[model samples]
Every structure is written in C-alpha cells, then in structure tokens.
Target: MNTPQLTESIKSLVDNIDREYILLPEFQRDFVWEIRKTCDLFDSLVRNIFIGSIIYGKPTFEITVREIDRRPRKGEGSRRKLKVISLEKNEINHKLQISNFRLILDGQQRVTSIYRALKGIDEIWYVAKNEDELSDEIKSKELRDRTLEEMLYEFSLQEDPDRLSIKLADAFEISKGIIPDDIREQYFEKLSFIAGMDEAEIKENFKRYYTICIKLGELFNSEVLISYYLLNMDNEKFALFFERSNSKGIQLNFIDILAAKLYKGFNLRDKIDELKDKYHPNNLDREIIVRTIAYLVSDGKDIDRNYILTNLNYNHFNRYWDEVCELYNKVLNFLFNENFIISQSWMPYENMVIPLIIYLRESEQKDFSQMTEWQYEFIKYWYWATIFSQRYSSGSNEAIIQDANVLKSITKGEKITDRVFFSRLKSQIDSYEDIYSYSKKVNVIYKGILNLINYDAKGLSDWNNSSKLTPDKKLEDHHIFPKDYIKQQFKNDDQALSLMDCVANRTLIPKITNIKVGKKPPSQYLTELKNSNSKLDITLKEHLIPNEIIEGLYDEFFTDFLEERSKLLFELIKRNVIDKEKSIIKEYYQAPKVKGNIKIFATYYSKKVEATFDIESQKILFLGESHSVPSATNKAKFYLTGRNNTSTNGWRFWKFIDENGEEKYIDELRKLSRK
Candidate 1:
C-alpha cells in the first residue's frame, strides 16, 4: 500500500486551493459539518491531535468543481462563497473555470471546518484561556461555550492576495462595529486578559507582538495529512472509489455533486426550486425528478453509481430535458388523479414512477395526445402489477432497467399479455397465502389495495362516489369482526388476534361509520346499514364484501368470513389488475389460514377533537377517544410538525401509560414497531 503524503501545511493547502491546483470533485459529498464539530476540530488542532488525513484524486482532464463553503448552513440559500485567489485569468469569455478543479476525496469537512474557524465567521471559534482551564476537556471543547474568549480577526481579501488576517485587540477587532453584543463581550474578555499583562509579559508569554503573529503562525503552520491518488480522466473509477469510501464512513451525498457537475452554469438548483414551488415535493421527490431525467435520457439504461459519475454533465440531458419535464409533470398528475398521495407514507418507491414516465413520454409520440386506450390499459396494468408484486422493493435498478426495455417495446406496438407479464413478474409476486397473510396496513401492498378499491368501488360511502375518492376524504380501516368480539370468541389466542389484523379482514369505510360500528359484529352493522341505505347491496358489491359472509355473521364463523373475503379480494384484484380471465390464476389465489398469531393493539387516539385527524379513520384510539395518528399525541406530533421539525419534541411531550404500568413516550411504540 502506498503511504499518503503528510507534509502540506494549512497555508500550503489553502494556497493550492486558491491557485486552482486543488479542487473538490463533483462526486464528493457536500460540506455539512456542524459549527460545534468544526470548533472541536480546532480544539484538536491546538491540542496537536492527529485529526486524520485527507484523500485527493488527481484526474487527467479538467473537472467541474465547487469551492468549500466557508460558511455552511442547513439550507443552500444561506450559504456564502469563500473568496478564492485566481490561479490564472480567464483567456476566453472571462468566466472562472469551474472545470479545472481538484477532487477532494476526503477531509473536506476538516478543511472547511478550519477555514470557518480561522475567519471567525458564524461564531465557530474558541480561545483557550490557560493550561489549567484547557485541562478541563468538557469546558474546553464546547462548541457554544459562552465562557471562552472569542478571537476576532480581519482578512484583507483583495489587498493581501494571500488573504491573511490579524486579530484586532490581540488580533484587533476590525469587525467591532458590526459584531453582536454577545460576541463583542467574548472578544472583550480576551482583550482584558491582554490589558492586564505587562508589555514584556504579553510579548513573551502571550505572543502578542507588533502583529498578531502567534495566531497567524499556528493557523498557517498546522499540518493536514493528504493522501493523494493520481488517476486517468475516468470519472467512473473515481466514483467507484468515492462510493466505496463513503459507504464505509459518513455519507456526504452524491446527488448535489452530480447536480452541480451536470448542470454547471445552467442553474439547475433554481429549476429544482421552481419545481418545489409548483409541486411542493420534499427533497427526495426533487432527486427522483433528476434521476428520472437521467434514466430516460440514457435510453433506459440501469442507473448505477458508475453511470451517474460519468454522466455528470448535462450534454445528454440538454437533448430531452423539455420532454422529460413535461412527461414527469404528467406522471405526477396521473398520481394525483389516481389518489396516490405523494407523501412519504402514501407513495411507494418514487423511482418506480420513472419507468412509467418514460413509457408515457414515449407513448405520447412527442405530442402528449397520441396515446390510445390500449396503451392506457397497459400502463395501468403495469403500474398496479409492479406495486402489488413489490417489483422495485429490492434490486430496483435491475428491475427498472428490465421493465424499461419491456415497456419501450410495449409502447412500440408489441403486445404484452397478462401471461407474459405475469411470467416476468412470477418470482416477485408472492403466493396467494402471502397476500392473505398480510394483517396490517403498514405494507405498501395494503395501500395499493386501498387505492385500487377507491377507484373501483363506487357509491359505498356517504361521499356518494368512491370512484372519485379525493386524498382529503378521511377513510378508516374497519375491522369486519370487531376487535372486542374477536377477542371474546378467541380469548388469549394471539394467533387469532394476528389473523384478525390481516388485510383479509379489513375494509375501507367512512370514518364515522367505523366509530359507530366499533366492536359490533359485521352482521349487525351490515344489516343496519342495509336498512338505512337502500344502495347497500351495490355498495357492498363494489367494495368486494362477500354477501355470503354478511348473511352468516356468527362469532363461530369469523375464520370462515376471513377465508371467503380473502378469496374474493384475491379474485377481484387479479381480475381487475392482472387480467380479466376466470380460473386462470386460481392456483395462486387460494390462501390457507396460517396458524400462530401475534398480539397487536388497537393503537388509537380519541374522537372528540376536531383537529385535522379523525378518530375513526386513523384507528388510533388514545385516552378513550378515537384520534388519528396526528391526534395520538406523540406519534401524531411527529407527523403534524413535519418530520425533523422537532420543535415540539413529541418524544418528550407525548406520554402514555404502558401495559407495564409505567409512563412512556409513544415514540417508544414506533421504535418497537421498527424492531
């Protein structure tokens, strides 16, 4: 193994960076080290800790690079650029050459961390008072330590060419007029220490000479170990190494790097922002849009790290950008119309939309109006089939590539029958027993069933039209045999409890009806519902509720009810989704009830609150009322506040009495569910 060079001083590295001799690679993850962590890094530097080495790749050709932001923020809009010196003036159109940049394979966090602390920007700096105080590790390394003496410095960016700085008091506070009161106080404390020292003592011990030479010397002389790799102009090789290294350590993220490289000078970030404004998609959605464009432009090729690395530039995207955008928008519209709400929980595999968009783009014949009814049917069948079969759940890239090629052919007038498609989908499609074994709505397959039923089942609820089920319409997962009734019959049989929660025993009903019919046997609810609504028979038929089971709703027949319902559901889905042939898939449609059960809770919240959540629809009954997940206190807060918006700290605020007779946060339940 070749040993990395460790001779570069901080000044040398900074100089190389300014002169364009060192550049960050397009595939390197962004600088996201927190401010305090950056301060800890500085502490390590002063303590002479070996903070680890940086890895750099030397490419044969010029590559697009981004300078490390000396001032990093949680969001991109708040970031400010580091002022860099020109290595060479532009001889052409006079714009700086973003292409002639160095690839930083590792240690970007350390480098930027150093840069920000040295600048005294964003309050990411600390000054140790004495060896005694420094020995207190906790006090010495706190990122936001209020007690530490703050160091302020002035940088002459234009005049110094080298961008050198000197502390104002000791360094001389050039930013004194603008510095905040708290920050100024920090600096003042350090100044007082110097003021107390005699001139000779200050010069000899504190190293405060005519210039702030000590600070400058320590900063410039600090050594950063650099492990440099020289390679040919193959982005593919570089990307493989980058991905492997990142996978083993902190994930910097490749999307931004690729985005910057591909759309250099084209303002791709602005385009994404525009899309965000229009569609209100999360960060993942935006990334999917970019990936979709890449996949289609590459002519249905598998999107691997190697492919992404080489295709960093937009030369290919430039050709089909408009068409991809148009078709992608149409796909989102399709999702909206189909009641496929685009939230994290509702949508399954956003990448799956790419192939569908590709088909739509190609099938439109460039006019968006050339698709025929047959093509539409094929699209619908392919979409639902892909979802039901978990086509993109794993090995998604290979699956998408396979589907893309097949879809391309299908769009070109080649006929693909259910038998042929099912053959391709056979390995992925679970057995009839697997589908019937699903006892919870957590599975995406369950969500898919609900979506299909929403479109297929009509006139089943108070809304008067199931076919036009809007995302806003609150729907509840109603148990066919009420939980209490099931427990009364099965008593302590965990297997029965598990079976009762299975998808086979559930149906989507209006939220109000779910609460009103809670714990009541299906026989009683159906009979009463039928009497109250004249259209009950048609509604039941649309919802795939077997008439035979409803007629015989005794507690002893609960297992039989699930069996019949499961069969009916299998037939309904297979016929409508795969193909409309009878007896063709009977072999794959029968599910024998698997014995053995697990105890699942009602997992609910109360009904009285008129908040966004509905008690009946959410099925989360808490404190004797039915409230959705949002109203379930802790779990609901996490949802209502939007993920990561932990201003309310649901884990702290949302408490519940555990069965163990102890009060615990509801988020504990979520953690248990994950396990």
Candidate 2:
C-alpha cells in the first residue's frame, strides 16, 4: 500500500527481479515513437546534461509491482509458468530486470537499442559512405557484402572511437590498428584508472542507480504505483503533472495519444504497420494525418493542443478511424492507377474543410471517377484560383470556418448553384480587360472561390505573395506573341506593342528567361528544341509547340500559337466554372410537389332594370289619344287585345349554365334594350 523512492543501487538489484510482476495485460497500449522524435529527445537530454540542468524533478523511474498467476502469451503453444517484472515508467530505468518483467510501456526503442548494444545483436546502421567506399559494386548491389556487426564495428572505429573502441578491439584486431593514438591513450587511461580503484571507490564512482527498486521505509511502493494512482484519480491532473515533471520537454503530439487509444482498442499499431508495409512504405506522420482529419471534420476550426488531446482520447478515434482507412485506400488506389498527382502546390486549400464538402457531395452523387484530362484541368484551375486568392493567408480561423460553412451550404443545395457561382466568377474576370486590372479582380475572385472551396485564401495569398522570391527579378509577363516581332513585322507601331502587354498575350515566366528570349521568334526556340540534347528542351517542345519552323515564319507562327494557348486557358477557366456549379447544386435544393385540380369558375349577372317605367299603365295612357283618333276604334281595340293575348301566351324558355353545370332561369317578361 506504501510507495517508496527507488535509488540507483536498489534499482540495479531489482534488475534481478522478475519482469512479469509489473507488466500490464495485453489491454495496455503498444510503445510508439518515431526515429526523428527519439533523436530529438536524446538531443534534448544531451543539451540539458551539458547545460548542467536537472534532468529529473520528482523521480527518474517507476516500477509497478503486482501479484498474479503467470499465463502464457496469446499465441504461444506452451503454457509456461514464469515470474516477471515490468518497467512501466516513461523515462529510462537502468535498474529494471530483463527476465521476469515485461516492459509494459516506453521500452520499444530503448529495449531494441539496449538489446542490440549489450547483447551484440546484429542490426543495420544506415550511414553515409565515402565516394571511394561507394564503388559500383556497393552502389549496384542489393545486399551488402559485410555482416551488420562488421559494419557497426567499422562505423564505431571509424566514426565513434570513444564508445566503440574497446568493443571493436575485442571483436577485431583491425580495429586496434584503426584506432588513433590519442583515443587509444584515453581508453587505456580510463581502463587502468578503473582497474586500480579499490572496491569502495568503484562503488562510489562507477555505481549504476537502481532507480526502479522499492525501499522498505518510503511513502510509496514504487513510482509506477504512484503514477497509476495519480492518473486514475484524474486524467487531466495526471497530464499536467506529467507535462511538468517530465522536464525533458518531450511533448507528445495529439496523434500519439490517438494512436495509443487506438492500440488500446484493436491493436491498431499492428494495423498501421500493415498499412505502411503494404500501402505507404514511409508511414505518413501521425500529426499530419491527425491535423488533416481535424481540418476535414472541424470545418476550419482551430485545433488547440488540449482540443487535440481530447479528440485523440475520444472524438478523433471514434469519428475518423473508418474515414482515415477509406481515405488511405483512396489515396493508394489513386497512386497505383497512375491518377492525377496530388501535388503539394495545392496542399493547403485542397485539404481544407470546404474540400471535404466537395468530396462528400461528389461521393454521394457519384460524380468522382477515374482521372480524366478535364478533371486534371479542373483541379489545376481550382488550385491556382485558391492560391491566388490568399484565403489561407491571415490570422482568421473564424473567416475560414465561415467560408467552410458557405461551402457546406452550397453543397447542401443552398441558394447558389455551381453554375451561377461560376458564371458570376467568370463574369468578374471578363469585366476587367486590362492586365493589371484583370489580375487584381482575378485575385479577389480567386479568394472568393477559395472561400467556397473551404480554404483560407487570405492566409495562402500572404504566404505566396511574400517578398521571398528574388526582388531583383519581376515575374515576366511573357508575350506569347513575341513583342519585337509584333512591333516590327505586324505594325511597326506603339499600338501593337501595347497589344502585347494584354492579358490575352501574357503569361507568367521568370524575368531572366524573358530577357533571354527577347527579340527571338518561336522559330529560334523551335530550332533549339530540335538541335539541343537537353531533356528540358524536349519537354518544352512537347508542351509549347507541336512542330519546328523557319525564322521568317514568326508573324504567322506566334499568331496561331497565342490564339491556341489563349483558347486552352479559356477552356480551363470554363471547366473550373462547371465544377464549381456542380459543387453548389449538389449541396442544396429539393424537388417540386404535384397537384390534382386545374379548372376554375366565375359568375355572370344580368343588367339592372329602370324602376321609373310602369309595366301595365304606360301603354294604356299613351294609347288614349291614338284610340280616340282611330276611326275604326272597335276594330282596332279588338286587334290590339288579340295581339297582346297571343304575345303573352308564347313565352320562350332560356337557361344560364355555370362551369360546374348548375343552371339558372332567364326572365322572358321584358323587351331587350339596345341603349
């Protein structure tokens, strides 16, 4: 139950103890460290030692002691009973036992190095060879002539006499001959001085610290036990303590923790090894991939150190394992099939959050296929656009996030479709005809498009537009139509020279190269292509022109050449537009709904009647005078009465029908009025 400080002497004595007693179960994570990082740690240690700084704060080592029935390893055939000690400390512990204990952690590189160095195990040490040593035989051969031991001995005697001399001398007589006199004398002095020392002096001066062994009267059993208690009590507290106490300043990257968590779950370390061996021989750095994943998932949020740690512990492993596997496979597939090169020129923007939206939309819509020339053009334009925009150029994580959100919205079927967005972009380009004006607008549009692509254009622009490029040189605005040829042969005027400065006539080239190509027609370059053995010329011939020409052909030659190159550039811009449109449409909008009824109805009304007119009395009152005038009054009256009766008896029937088929009766009592 108690913890104790294990000193150098006790640690050495405990080296004889069983290693198994301290090792954790298979559930414990694998040891992970890269060569570069390990080298850095050693460098730091050396620096601290030389600078006379304290290497250890609380303790130098930790030893965990546990009692359990011994069991055979997972795949072993024999159920061999054995006792072991485990060195669980993060730092080096020279005192731990090699036999009964297992190195539960931090022992991979150390154990390998120690086993090779002390046990004299054969291991290759890749070192640079002198030009004389790298003869055709050695250069051409797949396997080396000498054993690793011999090579190591050679390296030691030749390069590192202080450590390797005694071992080399014992192993081979040739080493003694190679050892310099000064080195030989130093080695002899140390050996003789040690040999002459009494037992007490030897114990005081040359004793190894038993830093892992437990003492009887200390507060804790071992540093490992205390570490376990501290870590298990509160993980963050343990991390903070570890960060502070580990004065070597060996900071663990987020991916390291993520890798550890993954190893804890499914032995992912082995899986990673398999992936590396079969797919990427040089395993992608864990930090790079982790950063990429964070960028992909976070939508341009800044990934802080603590955030990285938290993600590595939980979110990263849970969210990205399958995605990582898929991406790796996709990348490998692309590489194997000779797909478009994932050039580093577009690394920042291409790998941003918005690009993830593009990828997801493309994947979902089944738009992505094997690389075609057009796809290459599209990618190139997108890359160029993003680079020009400088979206990734500033201290604006929020801007980046906002841009990603916009991209996501577009991809999710929002207001802007790819076509509209691209049309607007191209419009912006066409609006500015002058070269400088065009360049400035294009740069702005480029940034806008980059924002759509989920990249920080400002950031990228700043970096790319820095004065790091030689100021003695300006980016040459090459006249595809040779300027002198245009002026002298075409017009012999300033107007033609002005035309040569047009964007349509210009492309970027190194200023020095531009000066060299001055006044010469394409014919001269064509001739150089045909005559020169340089592969650069050959490449230029294929890329620049299809056929060789004579000097006088300049006027006709460059005209055609500029026209074609301009057309090609125009096509590239067009394709970029199409891709952007596609990205937008895929991210937004839904289909329309159906309806059943189509017909509609309206009502009709009859004209209003005149209320002043009397229907029955009017005829009689007006007829009074006429009746009196009529000589055959009796005959007239009888005729009138008969006519009125006949008219009244003969009523016609009419009906008004509505759209829905309901009918209404019409009045037959009144005369039809024209006025």
Question: Alpha-carbon error at 423 in model 2, in Å?
Answer: 11
State the lDDT of candidate 1 residue by residue for 18-41, as single tens digits.
Answer: 565566665567665544455445
| After superposition, candidate 2 runs with Cα above 4 Å error | 1-288, 295-306, 309-315, 318-322, 328-342, 345-348, 357-367, 370-522, 528-571, 578-675
Q: What are the C-alpha RMSDs, in order, of all predicted structures?
A: 29.5, 39.0
- Cα lDDT of candidate 1 equals 0.51
Alpha-carbon shift of residue 656 in model 2 (angstroms): 54
> How high a TM-score does candidate 2 get?
0.28
TM-score of each: 0.43, 0.28
Question: What would the per-residue lDDT of candidate 2 be over residues 1-675, giving only the tens digit for each residue?
Answer: 233533322122123222322333333333222222322222222112111111122224664333222221112311232333444465324333233333334333333222222222321111222211233333233222322222221222121211112232222221223343443344333532233223433332221101100011121112221211222423333333444344466754334444666665545466566666654432333444455456555644644334555554445555665566555455434322331222222132333433433344344542335334444443444444443333333212333444444444434333322222232222233222212222211233322332222221111111112222221234444565576777766674433443454454553344555666667666664355345433433333322323333343444644455455445444444445434645533533221111121111111122111111122221111123321111222223234332211101000112223232333221111221100
Clash count, one per candidate: 26, 56
